[model samples]
Target: MIPQPTPAAPPRPARILIVDDSAVMRALLRSVVSSDSRLEVAGTASDGASALRVIDSVRPDLILLDVEMPVMDGLSTLRQIRARPTRIPVIMCSSLTQRGAQVTIEALASGASDYVAKPTGQPSREAAVQALAQDLVPKILALTALGSPSHGSARGHASAFPLSSPAAPPRTPVTANLAFSTPPQQPPSGFAPAAVLIGVSTGGPAALDLLLPGLPAAFPLPILIVQHMPELFTKHLAERLDSRCPLRVHEAAEGEPVRPGHIYIAKGDWHMEVSAHSAMPDHHSSSAPVLRLTRQAPENHCRPSVDVLFRTAAAVYSGRLLGVILTGMGHDGLAGSRILRQHGGVLLAQDEPTSAVWGMPGAVAQAGLANRILPLNAIASEILRLSARSQREAPDLRETDPREAGASGIGWVTP
Candidate 1:
C-alpha cells in the first residue's frame, strides 16, 4: 500500500495586545479577538506603563491602543512605543470628536498603523467592538507578513507622507478659461453636475498637505470638507491649512456663510449643512445668504460624518455639486455619493494605490458611484480645471479677491 500523504501544518495565529483603561473595553476586545480562530489576545493592559511591561513578556504581533486613558494617553503611549523603537504595529482606538480626531491624527503621525472610532452608545459600542476586530485582524496579519526588518525602515520616511509644507504667499490668479461641454459619453442613468465636495480620512493630512496648497485662492466654487477627526484636531487642521493654502480656511461655525474662495470644514461634533435660507434683507434691502450647523445624531457612526455633509450638499447643490471621497476605513461615504450621483453631482474618488487604507473610497468606486477615480496628485488639477470651466459658464459675480478676502478678518491665527 502507498504511504499516506503528509498534511501541511496550519498557519500560526496572530498575537495581539489589548490596551485600554476600561476593564469593559479589554473584555470586549478579548471576546472579539477570540471569536476569530486566526487571532489571539496575547495580553492586556490598562495603561501605557503596564502596556510597556506586558509587551516585554508577550511580544505581541500587534497592539490595539486606546487614545484616552489614565496615566498615559494614547499619543504619549504611541510616542513611548516609537521611542523604544518596538517593531510592533499599533492601531489607535479613538472617539469621533474633534479632540479625539486630532489626537488620533497625531498618533498616526507618531507611528500608529491606523485608527478606528470608538463606539458612541451601548448598542453602537457593541457594533464598534465587532467592527474593530474585523478591521484589525487583517492589518495585524499584514504587519506580521511585512516582518520586523521592514518595520523600522517603514518609519524612517514618516515625514515623507506630506502632512504639512512651508507656506508660500498667494500667487496671482491664473487667467486660463476652460469651457464646459457634456461629453458624448455621459454618466450612466444619473445626471452629472459641475461642482464637487470632498471627504478624507487617515492619510488625509498628508494628502491635503499636497492638494490644498496647490489650489489657487481664487478657486471659483465653494468647497465643503468633512475630514474624520476629533474636535481639537479639526481646529488644528483649519489653522494649519489656512497658513498653507491661498484660499480662506475656517472651522465651520453655526450660521456662518459658505462662499467661493473659501473652504469650510465640519466642526468636530456638529453636522454642517449647505442650505439656501430665504435671504434676509440687508441695510441696502438686498438679500444675504446664510449657512447653518446642526447638533444632529451622528451619521455613519460619526458626527460631522462625511456621508451627512456630502448628502446634504448633494440635495441642495445637485447638478452643481461635485463629490470626492478620499482614503479612509469603512463605508461611511458610499451612500452619500450614490445620492450625489442620482442628483447630477460629479463624483471623484481617490484611487486605492494612493489611499492609506483604501477601504472607504474603494467602496464607492467599486459600487460605480464615482465618475472619475484619480490618484492624489491629479485631484487638485482636476478641481482647478472644473472650477475654471464653471466660472466661464456662470461668470459668478460673487467672486471675491482672495488676497483682499484673506485680509478681511477671514484669516485669523488660532492660539
Candidate 2:
C-alpha cells in the first residue's frame, strides 16, 4: 500500500515580551496579542528594569516596549536590549503628542525595530481602538520572527494577519511585477544623479539610522526621503538621524534649495516636491532646483506619498534621479517608481530579509521595476559608486513640460 506523505511541522508561535508600567496597558496588549494564536504573550514587565531582569529567562523573539516607564524608560531599555548578545526585535509603544513624538524618535534611533502610536485624543474611541488594532497587530506579525517568510509576501497587509490557529504559516505571495535583477543597461555609461529619492515606512527610523551612517558626508547627491509619519514626528526623526550620521539631515523646508551632501526629509502631511526652476542663483545652477511643499491628497493612503516625490522628480531631473524604496508596509512607492524607470531613472530596493516589512520593496521587486535589489548595508556604497560617475551638468531641467512641474490642482487637506 502507498503511504500518505507526512505533514510538515507548524511554525512555533512568536514569543513576545510586553513591557509597560501601566498594568492596564500591559493587560490590553496581552489581550490583543494573545487573541492571535500565531502570537504568544511570553511574559510581562512593569518597567524597563524589570524587563531587563526577566528578558533572558523568557527568551522572547520580539518585545513590545512602552516609551515612558518610571525606571529606565523605553529608550534606555532599548539601548540595553541592543547591547545584548542576542538581538531581539523591540517595538515601542508611543503617545501621539509632540513630546511623545520626540521620545519615540529617540527610541527608534536607540535601535527599537518600530513603534505603534497609543491612541491619545482621537475624536472617537472606537476609531482609535480599531486603528490601534490594525496598526499594532499587523506590525507585530510582520516585524516579529514569525513574520519572515521563506519567500516574501508581496503585500503584507493582505495576508500577514492570521486569525485562525492554522498548523502552518502561510506562504509568501509572489507577483509577476517584482524586480529580480538589476536592469542590465540602466544607469547607462555616463549616468550622474541630480538627486536621490527614498521612500520608507514601517521600520523606517531604525532602518535609516543603520543605512545612513554608511554613507559619507561628501556624498554628492542631495537625498530626499518620504517616510510615512505625522507632524512633529518627522522633525524629531530628522533631528535624531542628523546627530548620529556623518551627513547633515534636516526636515525639508518649502523654499529651501536642494544641495549636495545634505539629506532633506519630507515633513509630515506635506507632499515635498522639487521645482523645475529655481528663481534665484544657486549652487547647482544659475537657477537652482527648489524644494516645494504641498498638501496633496494621499496616495496609497499616505500623504507625502513616495510616488508624488518620485514622479515629480522624474519630470524635473530626467534620468538623473535615483529612486530607492526601503522597508515599508505598503506599495506606496511602486507606481511612482514606475514613472521614474520609464524616464530612465535607476531604481533600487532593500532586499526582503534585511527589511522589517518587505511590502514596499517587494512591490517594486515583484513589478520588475527595481534596477538593483540590494541589502541595507550595500545600498550606501552603491549610491557612492553610481554618483561618482554621474554627469557633471544635469539634463536641461526645462525639457519637461511646465504642466507636469506643478502639483497645484490636486486636492489637498490643510495642515
Superposed Cα deviation of residue 52, candidate 1 (Å) = 10
Cα lDDT of model 2 overall? 0.76
* True-vs-predicted CA distance for residue 270, candidate 1, Å: 2.8
Task: Please give, for residues 1-415, the per-residue lDDT of candidate 2 as tens digits.
Answer: 9999999989888888999999878877887787678999999999999999998899987899999999799888888876665656678899878888999987776556678888666576455556677778777777664554422342222111111113323443333344455443456666677889999987788678878877664455789999998878999999988887767889998778777767899999999888877544543543657788999789888888999999888888988888899878768998999899898888888876567678888878877788777877778777777776542343223223222344223231111
**Each model's backbone clash number:** 15, 13
Among these predictions, the greatest lDDT belongs to 2
Model 1 regions lying over 4 Å from their true place? 1-12, 17-38, 42-61, 65-89, 93-103, 109-113, 116-195, 230-233, 278-289, 393-415
Q: Candidate 1's residue-wise lDDT over 228-261, tens digit each?
A: 7666677877877788888788888765666666
TM-score of every candidate: 0.63, 0.79
